[model samples]
Target: MDPHPPPPPQPPNNPVFPPQTPNGPTIALRPQMRPTSTLRPQTFAGSATLGMCRMKEWWLQVGLLGVPLLAVYLHIPPPQLSPALRSWKSSGSFFTYKDLNIFYRDSSGAVGSSDIVVLLHGFPTSSYDWSKIWEGLTQRFHRVIALDFLGFGFSDKPRPHGYSIFEQATIVEGLLRHLGLRHQRINLLSHDYGDTVAQELLHRYEHNKTGSILINSLCLSNGGIFPETHYPRSIQKLLKDGGLLSPIILRLMNFFFFSGGLGAVFGPYTQPSQAEYWDMWTAVQNNDGNLVMDSILQYINQRKKHRERWVGALMSTSVPLHLIYGPLDPVNPHPEFLQFYKKVLPMSTVSVLDDHISHYPQLEDPTGFLNAYLNFINSF
Candidate 1:
């Protein structure tokens, strides 16, 4: 017998069958045939329809949750103005700029000095930024003035309006004319967004533009005057070009987001206090100011577009010029910003504060900022 043997033959109708054992029952094999069922075969059309239905259901669920959340976010009331902010608002008055009401603070400071200093604040913030140095400034200058530019603190935040540096410069001019100071030589102290406004004003003054304010001297601190070296934060970039997302982001903005973002620009040791952050947030919440930020951020683009007019004003003007910089500023960081600033604006005096100081130097290092400004003023 062969070690391996072939299987026993099966009937023609049954191709396979189990072998019978000595005592076990034999299993039967059935003929192969096509099986029938009630279920229909799936088709590409059916798959596509199923997918579409799932997508529709997903969107429906999202909409069901999203709409109410959006409504709640949009309807959330703006914060109540803090007592300090209220006092600040009460102390200041508004002047009409066209149909819009502009908020400003004017103090008749030291009588001995005839120097008049006008303060232009940064973006997303109001003249309240100058509160830290307000008293110190008053002690040195005869007249001190600061304003919340259109769309800023306590100012009319008109929607669907074109907000630009040129318009802001015009507003400053109108404020001066309104106060009967149009003919007097004045000092300009500006920071961040205000720096660009100051530059435009300087351009107007140098070119003898009609109704331009006379400038005695000009000082800028930590502004994106040079777009090349200016680094806007991630949120800023998004808001500037966010389009639809801008509106959503603006509406969702609150104290936590605002404070976190603002606090990042400050140095580790120089961060703002909780109360300070609350005050800043309150000002932004006023008059729905947060909604206008994207419109206001168009200045970043405006800065790049009109760099020549503004930077040239600094380079060619005969008026005294100075820069008070916080080297740690992320927006306009050290080395790059300072190198470019010094190279381009060599004629302008520079005051570089301690390494730890960052943006908002006036608030971060008020004493150093005030001292630097006063020194520049007294230098000439």
Candidate 2:
């Protein structure tokens, strides 16, 4: 049997999206227009008996196939924002970016402080990933800011919008400008997809395409920066290959698939707790955010498209750069990847964790991660 099942029949002409919030800038959600419905109630009259027999067979097959999926779905509790997230939201602020409300946390109650660090989070998670280290950095730096890109985290997750790394870079720049950091020396910290965005920012900064902002130093964790060396997970490969049917498949199996995928990325020694999994799940499931996994995974493709520019940004940027890697990261692991980084930019400060940490070092080994980060920034 073909792995991809046929798409379900289209709904009758109806508004698919909820009405935009009254106070925010109007979102651009065009109605999903489909040709007229093919199955009218009267059309089935002649074939009622045949249809009924076929429907019975279909239901039997569906029931057998769906029992496990239904059980899995029903077993998982609906997600909720954790107390940490609730506290962060209370202290954080929001601003409109491209008609969507963007969420961010800033330590600088007063602007114009020269010392700054901007944290960019990786995929399938958000600024809340910084929760472990947010307080630690705030004490040492004059300003520390972290924002959820448009599609992820507390930021608005618009279904049809293009979630490109370039656009992500633009949003970060916009945040910098909004906070009056355009002309200031900004320290950068990133992991996973955030590493790609940092590379784009570095490229733009070197070319003078960005505003007056200056990157004094950068510390990027494990990510698919050198696309050639990166290996994506099985779920990622499936969604990329599944085409239009992927989103539908994702919606059906998000909780099961996401939880498993998260488990795989962590080092064997330090897996996430059940509560941590729920917190991450709640972030993605909010506003049907899991539906856009297909759109967001397109960043892997974009990484290949701009590999030369981003990789060259690493190869050539004058800003001091560091790579603090979770050596055992299954998704973007060491040996090959770290070797590639050292091969191209041998002099860039590099640290491989001894604790067998995985992709999310800040969560797995916050002290080690923060020490490496603080040392890197303070060195400059």
Candidate 3:
């Protein structure tokens, strides 16, 4: 008796299948019970499928490259600004000069005649943050001037110009000059990238104490002053290439900041949340577009351009300076970062707020931060 089962009869139109080979063909070894798939001859359909797949891959590559250029042109991101931030602005009482808009809260009622305090805001935030202290600030100073520098708050967002920190500094100085505040050395309070703009003002005018020396003293919150010292991984890369990665970051951050929905913009630092504070913060950015100019200037151009000069000035300032910051700031925390500043600025006083505050210490503990700053300046 034959051990093998009988082979099935071939269909009328089917061609004879070729014998399977070890390398040339993949065969299911059940020869006695041949199925159509195992026995069918290879066809051009496989080649066609492969060709289609390759074509799809090629087009995908082209699209990946073209998409960014298109986005750069269109100014639309996969993510956009949240309505919370989009509507956030200083529309109430700001004076616009070209792209810059200055918001002044009258401090006429403050002391007899306190020196003018000009507040420069950080990236993604505007003069609005000052609202927390706006009443108090206006109540304290002879005048408090807060502005949305180019591309922030209610100011114009222009493109492809100098738009650098120094450029903005000139704009800020011009505003002061226009307002006749230059004659009296200006007091400066700054945070985040506002620190860099403040430094730029100091770097240009204060060093020689010559042609345009204006800023009298500084109350600096975290940032830009010490790049190499306080850099975390993300920020290190941002400066590594003059902020080429900034656009991507600006978009991603806007997405996250917006996608966060209701409670996104508010954190513990924004505590004692007043309706006014939330409104101002959400006002700075409505779309990712507003962030581009700030990111490029703050991370790419400003920090890289003045890293050494600012550090030297910070470490050995001709003018009085103070560092009032929180311990848990994401960008400029103390301990490791403070060690570097301490090494350079041994004489510079460093005050740490007890709670975990992000960048804005003044907003974090207004009473503590204000009292400390007032004492430091008065003693000086």
Choose the strongest candidate by lDDT: 1
Clashing pairs in 3: 85-282, 86-286, 88-282, 88-283, 89-283, 242-300
Error of 2 at 12 (Å): 73
Candidate 1, 1-380: lDDT as tens digits? 99889877654554375445445687665655555322234466688899999999999999999999989978888787788888999999999999999999999989878889999999888999999999999999999999999999999999988899999999999999989999999999999999999999999999999999999999999999898999999999999999999998998888899999999999999999999998888888888989989999999999999988888988999999999999999999999999999899889999999999999999999999999999999999
lDDT of model number 3: 0.62
lDDT of each: 0.92, 0.84, 0.62
- Candidate 2 local lDDT, 80-109, one digit each (tens): 678976787787898888788899999863
Sort all candidates by TM-score, best to worst.
1, 2, 3
lDDT of 3 by residue, 4-87 (tens): 878766434323454545356534443354566644444566777898999999999999998897678556432333454443
Of candidates 2 and 1, the better by TM-score: 1
How high is the lDDT of residue 218 in model 1? 95
TM-score of 2: 0.80
The runs of at least 3 residues in candidate 2 whose Cα sits more than 4 Å from the true structure, single-residue gaps closed, are 1-78, 109-113, 210-212
Which model is ahead, 1 or 3, in terms of lDDT?
A: 1
